[model samples]
Target: MLDKTGDAEALGFDALADLLNINRVDREKARREGWRTLADLVAVHDLENSSERRGDEWGAGSPLYQACHVALIEFIRTAPAGALPDPFAPGEIFGPKLPPTLTVV
Candidate 1:
């Protein structure tokens, strides 16, 4: 689950597990093994059944996979081209300011 934060954080593999319909065991095991990014999880699972992970494996078909693919791509495409400001530099320290559409239980 994404924390309520305005600062765009790198979307991790665990976050996309539901969308990918990845099993819980695989997700938890991946997390324990320090698989942070989608590419990392793919590498561990051999999603393509090949020696190396390929981006094309997730292309087209499978609505859930498509959603993840689009979301990840859009995230990278729209990312700012500069380093982010240090959140702890000085002054006010506020909690995350996420999108209003998101609701955390």
Candidate 2:
């Protein structure tokens, strides 16, 4: 099911492929390029203009292409940027560091 603007939808691999209107080959290519989720696809939008994909198709001035681009932009803009913990942050993951000395019993 799709929500308003057709942005909010649980998009698995198949659904994402459908939304992108890409075929099996392209999908596989995208997967190979580390495009696992819809957000990943949006993040890799540079490929649309870059010489990454097999064919320079996305950059073409097509209605579907424009729509897809706009949809992704809007979706990403509206969606919440999920908060992820920083691995390097002190005490969060490593916890409090104890003294460097080790006492033998």
Candidate 3:
């Protein structure tokens, strides 16, 4: 699902629904109104190049909007002491993540 192309020319969300036999606008309205289906729950994400209405909503940070700040802070902390500038702090809505793998040595 990670479209590395990030092609802005790709089809809009509703146009895609039409191909799947659902009217796009109607589907979105229903989802927004809380009538989401299993497929809706899966497909409704902060996708790249969303419909004209969505207009690039989610940036480098996912919908939670903390990764960018975290990366910035990490970058600043790693910088040389005298050259480092105060970095912008990420908001306090962080959560746990899946841990990396390891093996007994």
Candidate 4:
């Protein structure tokens, strides 16, 4: 069965109450935050942190660094021989172009 945060929270509270030998609320509070699972919460949290981490270089202990290292390893393992692009090759030209609606004064 798929695990939900609400289910875990309910189980945890129930266990805690049982261990403490005390009465607790019978109903669980409605979660309006939309995250239903631990994975969902983690994904949202990672996305929130990603923006903050973008400007900084990945440190050795950073999750981003670990993820990038794993990705690079997987890419190297699966990539076909000689499929990599040449870094010295001339790339497409990119520059600001005048808009068609503008006329020279």
Judged by TM-score, which candidate is best?
Answer: 2
True lDDT of residue 26, candidate 4: 18
Report the C-alpha lDDT of model 1 over 22-79, residue by residue, as the tens digit.
6666667766887555445443353222232335554643443455567767877787
Listed per candidate, the RMSD to the true structure in angstroms reads 14.8, 9.1, 15.5, 12.2
Backbone Cα, N, C clashes tallied per candidate? 1, 0, 0, 0
Of 1 and 4, which scores higher on TM-score? 1
Best by lDDT: 2
Q: Cα deviation of 63 in candidate 3 (Å)?
A: 4.1
Cα deviation in Å at residue 84, candidate 1? 35
User: What lDDT score goes with residue 63 in model 4?
Assistant: 55
Error of 2 at 50 (Å): 15
> In model 2, what is the error at residue 85, expressed in angstroms?
28
C-alpha lDDT of all candidate models, in order: 0.50, 0.54, 0.43, 0.40
User: Candidate 3, 64: how far from true, in Å?
Assistant: 6.3
Colliding residue pairs in candidate 1: 6-97
lDDT of 2: 0.54
Q: Please, what are the lDDT tens digits per residue for candidate 2 over residues 1-105?
A: 123454524566667666656566666787688665544454344323323344456544334445667876777778765644554555556556545777899
Q: In lDDT terms, how accurate is model 4? A: 0.40
